[model samples]
Target: MTTFSRRKALALAGAVALATGLAAATPVLAQDCEKVDLTFTFWGSVNEKNDIENAVKNWNTNNPCIQVKPMHIPATGTNYVQKLTTMIASNTAPDIGYLGENQAFQWATEGKILDLSPYMGETPDQQYIKSTIYKAGDTLMGTGLATGVMLIYYNKDVFDAAGVPYPPAKADEAWTWQQFVDNAKLLTKDRSGKNATDPAFDPNAIDTFGVTLPSWWGGWYPYVMSNGGQFANEDGTALTLNSPEAVEALQGFQDLIYVDHVMPNPTQTSSLPTGDVLMQSRKVAMSMDGMWRVTDFAKLGINWGVGVLPKWKTAETVVLSVPKVIFSQTKHPKEAYEFYKYISDPAQVGLFKSGLWAPHEKAYFTEPDLLKTWVQAEGSAYPPEAMDAIVDYTLNHAPQQAPVYQLKNIGQIMSEAVEPNIQQIMNNKATAQDAMDKAVATAQPMMQGRW
Candidate 1:
């Protein structure tokens, strides 16, 4: 439960002492009788780190023969990758670690990570959500540590003050893009108490924005898919960012800031706090964000509600997670897999109750009792409507694999082409079509085929 800074120093010292102790002890007659040490590396918030450390402590206490050390890496995204890569290069990779979906595939292809197929068994997909299982051809790389899906989080007080009806919870009853925009307009008000629909409404002096459209892929990708767009073709051999469907969806989001004026622009949004804070303070009426925000919203004590995302041709969302994988260089594969299984289980970890993660196993969705263990659990913090808005929608309406899971070299593509051009489009410096066309040109050559 210690902070990362203190935990890092203590872990290193304990590892050194453990190594010395084992080296000085009399040689054990059987390999099974000898003590085994395994390291698990991961990156996340302080709460998540504490949760994992507690799990490791419990495992170590219960299993004296196989002691697991928790290695806390307090970095995420590219920085995490950089540190992990340095460890691998120095031949000091942990037995297992949390890896981004894109990097998991890339590493699996390079044989840097172990194929977990033998441990998970044939038809691993039968146990886990098919989308969350990472593979290179037939070789299973790893499974998601947990699953996450996007949802429309709105401030009930804001909608009530504007006399606007709440958005629908079920996918079948989802609002159309136009209807969503119309509602957003009604909720958007200027400092003079004029809604966006009012002719006298001043955009320059807005008191509250109707929405905060996410510029990140997790926020916008669902809309693109719902509009019948694909980031790449099924084979993942080419970039399809310039497709008509993609152009339309991206433009529609941009229009929210420019033409509709219901959303804040890049500069304006940068000055605002995160989505959860935005809703709590009523600075924005609604936000399209990951369900993980439930933890923050619950603590903020905001009067909030969950709703299915608005649809274009279909109501769709993306489910994703960072996978925990066993390294190829591990000296104790058996012990590593054991700890991996222990930590990945929702029932074993405390993350589910904090609303930071969802169960990755298919049974959690299909089995009523298992579903209630997390969704309806006392400290879960999920809104009442989450059963329909998130769980049901994800199980029935959402695509199994998000673009990040399907596309190869996605991290590079996002950095080199997608992110930069998308920012330009959001800034109103370029049109969606023009920006995507430019992005596609740069990303096409980087496509190395999907996993």
Candidate 2:
């Protein structure tokens, strides 16, 4: 794959996305399903395809009557969407597929996906992360097979060399907003041994930046939440991103590049896979990114330390997980739910073992021995001890967030109206308040609709 394609793909790596304006999935004509041979499909690399296929094999061993056929959407020019949209319209969609959690809910609003609640057994004591597995208004849309946690990653070598203590692993020990920024300033340095705080330091022609802040909402949401800002009112009905608190949070983040001059500018991080690369090369000393990076970062072999994001009003970060969904058109609803349950069985992906996913099942976070299964997996890249604080912070402290998923068509609003302004802030062309005001002006009417 081209680097650009890889970057595009990785952008959708932890958080997810898709388009609007595609006609709603058509109502399927009645069809018999005496044989009950269901189709399961998704878009992924060969290895991911194999892992999914193998998971299905395990499910098939017990359920002999319901045979599942796996389908891999070919990688060609947004081919996954092309095929899925066509299939849904033509009444040939798979019984189950990876309809990114956010997109699936939107399609479900348009009558495309099956609500698995009826087929669900009574809620078990141990279950998936409540925020991710449940839908807006309490509808059970699909099941999450994996989890992603946003974390601040620091280069251990850089922290040691600079004599700056590593950011704390525990939430209680987190640095405050100003403290975090100040530490970032200290980490930033030029080739001539000058930090960002130095009188002679140059913002331009910098050797290494302290951190890299992302304009993407997933990355920005934490800062906003930490500052007691709200992107939307409860139940996802209103835009509050222009609120004073949010504006200040956004300004603080933009200042990392523009005012404090501690972080890389948007142009510098435009290269593929963003944060991990800068840290690996030591071009950046620290980065704010999701833990799903372990699958890739482990290979870089850089000595990195995980740190807890600082609190302002209080600690907060983005909480989201991609889900596997069942199509409403599936004639075999029972069989589809059965297979969907198996695929989303949490243990299937082994992502936690690989350090690319955090624990979604409550047990993994609450019980030490149970949690060790993945954290201490052989050759694991994640530091079991260092990650405990993050896990505690995620489970007990981090608020369950809606992001672009709970509210239908919000992703479109974010892309068309919100992202440009975020870019403007990063480019130092507009203040966060001004940019957000313009964004609210542009997006408010569209978002007012229940779509």
Candidate 3:
């Protein structure tokens, strides 16, 4: 095993491209099993890979029927699908794999994955929420083994030093958009120690940003939803990003960085850690990011707190969970079904939860003593109360938009139209309306052609 020092880890993290080379060799057999070896392909950072491996190792011990190996693919972002498609076509694809939830329904439509309904029906344990397991068409996919919630994460040390009250924990108790803006203004300060309100507060000399929202798809989705616009139509038949509400939402996101001057420009944010504005620790007072940020923060040993995202008129945010899927092409269908069933068992799911993946098990949140035991044993990195708050928010308030599947070339369109214009808006190159108008004009026809 390679030992990573603090300096080395930071350097590695800083220099690391999200892209990783696919490991050609499978892991050595840890223990013998009756079933054939199965490889699992996934895309994430080294830390994420380890967490997944830890979960798989636990599953491996008692189930002498199968030995599972993990393949850590390079972080090409959305390019992962393309890579997996190539591997699948080449017949070298792993028996079990990971896919974007948005893409899963589409893939299922093409018969790319094994229908897990039979296996799920046989399981007596209520390991998953029925709501979470359904696909875009409300077809039962597989058990949504783990989920990610879009949330507001704050630096406790920064809030403490700045003397601002930390954001609230419960989703229902979250601030309104204006109140959130006001709090951010209080926390944002210039090099001369003037807050955002002071006339002498130099935007150029601003030492701490009120927030750092990235141009990435995940970062921008909340803004779109905040204005009651979703990326796709309800049935996933068409793109709706050019809707009036979407225009308003995109404009607001632009104003935060451009007009307010309280956020970093696109170049600054892109060059920042992992192209993640929220991962900058003390540099940003408040930022919206995925729940997995907690797992990343644990590595830095920073005291961070999770909070509900401020509400629009409708109080909504992203709640997506990617699951391990069995490919339709697997040779050993019976054994494959058995393995999927095994992973979905509550005990196996609890192992995954211990690795910081959100539990789809409603019991983790509903039962008091069980919830307490979960925090003590598996959730030491986060407050159990905060996790519960997030879970509740997802259950009650989570929006059900089709995952960016309306546009065939979503990743490209985002880079070309969305990111550039959002960048221009942040740099004060254009007004929210003008930037959005141009983005809509460019993306509308482009997306139409693809669809």
Candidate 4:
């Protein structure tokens, strides 16, 4: 046998993957698929476990020889990456798995995962609202099994109780920043029934907040982008949070908690746990978060409503992607690819309507039936008007990229230069200008290591 170094083997495998897997009409590799039990690893709750099991059962019913077992990784954040990396290095990694945006870029670049070029089955249709589903460049890093977008989820009961109309669903018709603030003022009420706009309204006595966004950068990133902020150069090489637009965006959120006091203080939310509970319990009337929360809200029977994000200088929100990648060290690439394909298949449109995900395919967005399959649910899902706006307006209007994700060592960069300073801004430890300046000062030096 010819000796092949590991990296050479990696490159050769990628080439082979591209060669044998045709992008169209490619037959499954004719092999004994049932005798093989491929273990797929992922992270999530029991609900995810159930979803994967359903998908596996659907695929396994016909292919008895090839069985796919969903393995619960029981890990999160850095721990997830570390455990999976160790598994890969030890040649004991599961056959296929989920790769977050940071890892998809980091690992696929290093050839630690399979490129699915040949097995993709078709040239992707690009007219969908959330186009560029995965930023794989020339490599088939993996298909994002589901695409999710940032939008506002408000409690319909809260809106009705406050006598406020629903927020706009269309991006073009999005509320201006001031209008959003004004609406929030109207929605917020204190224990004594005073609104935020009332001079007698005490922030300390707020019973229901007007709005609240997730604490993470994902929630606030769009604020900067919509305001024409360039937080960094197109490539994530340097920090620009100190720029006027970026600072203004950061301050805009800070003002909500401190100056305007329309938002709940971050320190006070430890009891609530999630945005869903905040809405369900009526502590917050409007919650800005990813569409995934629709699952939990729907299950809880909350009278929830969906709407596009409130635009600042322009209408935009960040798109969240979590792609599926095959480990290069897998012994059963064909069986693994089959399982990956089954779960990642665009035709599994039912996942969308269930509230766990949104469509990652152009057809689902363009074709009405496909869109309805994934989008229309009686409750805890987007209503008809909101569904149309998401498909026709928000999906197309959301930004092409998440500014903060344009980085190498994204976790490290964010930890050192971003989150802490952002905490300062949010907690009122520092003004947006000071917090951003500090973040830039710390993070600028680390950009030297970026890809």
Candidate 5:
């Protein structure tokens, strides 16, 4: 894996400047034209919203003829979807907005979203990471604003206290499943100072959990894939959640809580603080989460480190991002596309500086000069090993596109079948095999071929 150093990053400051200059060189409206107002709808935290508003202000200042109105929605998931659906129903949809992968494909198929292929100049594939570009067969539907991968976030202090070696930063050297569980057992301690490994350790009076086992599909799907299991077949025409590989992988996750007694269960986690706070307070030694958490961990001043997830059979991770699309109802297609392109560039949008996002373009990962622009910078929120744990792991170990990016009707399938069954397994109400068998049976009819 490629390793980055502070010296290399400092030396590449000139490359960062040149890249910024090129990105800012987009031609401003030279001739007088009627000003077009376009609304951009999206959801994010206060910081993210402020960044978008600032970017819009800059765009409006330069391109007077194409002023963009920023519409900030504070909600996400179902509420955001509901609001967006209502807007579309009322024919009041914004010119452009962020859409989840499932909805982007569904809307694009229904002709509710614009086909961006026409607006994209030749060689669009070369502009962004292929996985970040959302498409429906030959039609370009939308593109991810940024990309993120799943990985481990550990508190260095907790690891040192427990005398446990830190998880591997390099993907190739990732710990096996058993090793991760064993370390977690060592790290987990009770109020009486007994670790989980001790015979007298009290699970009910735990002081610190070893890790967090996320119930969400995004958290566990990679492990399933690592075990050569998949939720569905490649084309998404069949359900395969009940396969032996998937069942075994899921059972292993459940064992971390019920058998290994390291990670906290759902009821225990509900009363606990968020992941960053848990790590900072020494309530949890480690967390499995998306790379976006780097921003939160950095702000808390915790001595944290990034690491590749423990592997079952192969080192694998999921990469995902919200799709940014132009609404078909927009009257000003040209202006909307222009604004979309502007925000999609990391140089124009300042979110990258906070480590909340990774660039969607491939050059950012492959080109040493461009890689330094995001991965290694002065005062960067990213940890020292971010290049190997995140950048290199993402480029080499992660799937080209996660199932969420390609699976048809994935949202509905998860909501209706997969999530509920997985929840049952987490709650210990059902065995992994039985729960997954039910999931397959329930989701089989809902399956639609992949895009």
Candidate 6:
């Protein structure tokens, strides 16, 4: 029943607003006397930490009534969910926190996250892009967390040097999967100057790879999506990993290695850094990657050009976005809702958007130069058309797949069971079909017990 006033919350986020030209301190009224404290938990590196702290400072400066503290938990891998779940069980949960697109829905279904439908109503949903939020059921309006969009990144200098054409600035001309594979085959070469398809090509003596696929869950999303595979049924109850579409998708992904022979083997790939795949000595011509590539890898002296992900049956890619959820156990739901409204304002949203995190709102997409300016202000790492391609790809082709789990413990169980299978497929130790089949068999027991 304790509420942090809206005006106070605005003052609290002043630093964030100021950075985006909305930072003026708001007047604090006498009614702002409540001793309110809220904790925000999220995962990030030092630079990302600074960006978030700056946002929190802005909020504190403008709002004198509420005291908000930010907590950084190093949840490398699935530890984020593990630690947070422990906190919730003990009723020591933060008032508001970030949740992944899928994990958010699982938490929400467990009654851990507050339902914002009453708070959001039609106006907020109107501004929301359907692809950003996860849905639990067909008619359920909002039950999920954040979304991320996938993109193709090509080394422009490498392309130009190899005499291959660059990806177009817009999605309308984006290459299909076949074109992408052909380009990869063309760019892949050994020291003796043989492409992947050349009879003279030698895999053992290869010096450059056509592309790099991260051996993680992220890689599977595009493969399955591009091949017209659905990870789960529309209703989110049954597993769909054995479908022909999923098998086809897996075959396509595996083809990058076993069939096309353009990608590096899993052993060599495990040594790669998070975003610097293009920085390898045996040059990488392209990478199926995330938008974070611009902010994370642009400064590495690689001439990278981004394009919409190559299409298969349809031009689709997976998007990962986070949502800030209010705890159902919070003492001040109204005040928390007020904070949500205050921080999500366009000006504040713009600051977060500029910092490599995509905003959930739609207005940010229309500003063609917004993404380019944000990344360039730090340094000119990506090519000029990077933002154009990302925005075009996300707006036109990104579709939302629910990230929710069927059972309460499903988050931990699925992460544990699936990551290794992903590793197995990426390493070619097992076929995508074989790996996924084992994964389903393992997870089915857990889901049945929980759902």
Provide the overall lDDT of each model, using Cα atoms, as 2-decimal numbers: 0.79, 0.69, 0.62, 0.71, 0.81, 0.62
Better of 3 and 4 by lDDT: 4
lDDT per residue as tens, model 3, 1-451: 0112322432454211111110111222234544577877877767777877776776566555566787788757668788888988998767887776546666776777777665555432244433345443333456554566777777787788878887777766778777777778778888888878787889888778888765666677776787688776554344566678876776667767766667778767766665133534567887777776566665666676778777666677676666568887888766555555555433334433443566555554555433443344455556555654466776666655335533455555566777777667667787656776677667665463222
Q: For model 2, how does the per-residue alpha-carbon lDDT over 1-451 read when each residue is reduced to its tens digit?
A: 2324323433454211111010111212223434468999876544456556766676555455677898988745457767888999999989988766546666776778777667663444244455556453445675565566677888889988888888788877788989988888898998887999899998887888898766678778888888888777675556778999899889888888878988877677765345777788888888877766665566678888787777777876676667678888888887676566555433333545666556556655655444555666466667644454557767766674656655656767777778889889888999999999998887776574332
**How high is each candidate's TM-score?**
0.87, 0.80, 0.78, 0.85, 0.91, 0.78
Better of 4 and 5 by lDDT: 5
Q: Cα miss at 13, model 5 (Å)?
A: 14
| Candidate 6 local lDDT, 1-451, one digit each (tens) | 0112322434464322211122233623234577677787877666566666777787776676665688888758778878888888898888777776557766666677777666554333444555554444422224222234677677777787778888666766767778888988888999998888798899887777888877655666666776777666654454567678877777678889878988887877767654455443437887776675455554455566677777777777666655667877788776555555555443443334443555454544654333332333344344567556665566667664433423334465457666677777777888878988887777665543323
Q: Mind giving the per-residue lDDT tens digits that candidate 5 earns over 109-163?
A: 8888898767663434654554687887666876777888898999999999999
Q: Judged by lDDT against the true structure, how good is candidate 4?
A: 0.71
Note the residue pairs that clash in candidate 4: 21-118, 23-121, 33-65, 33-66, 34-65, 34-66, 35-65, 353-374
Residue-by-residue lDDT tens digits, candidate 4, 239-339 = 88899998988899999888888888877875655777788888888888877766666666778778888877888877776777888788888777777
Clashes of each: 0, 0, 3, 8, 0, 23
Question: Candidate 1: lDDT of 108?
Answer: 86
Top candidate on TM-score is 5
lDDT of 1 by residue, 1-451 (tens): 1224323433454211111011111222244677898888888766567767887887776677778888888774578888889999999988988987768877888888998877666643655554777877766876777787888989999999999989899999999999999999999999999999999999998889999878989878888899999998878888897999989999999999999889999999878888778888888999988876666676778799989999999998888788779999999997777777666655555567677778776656766555655777667878889999978887888864777777778889988989999999999999999999999999988988776
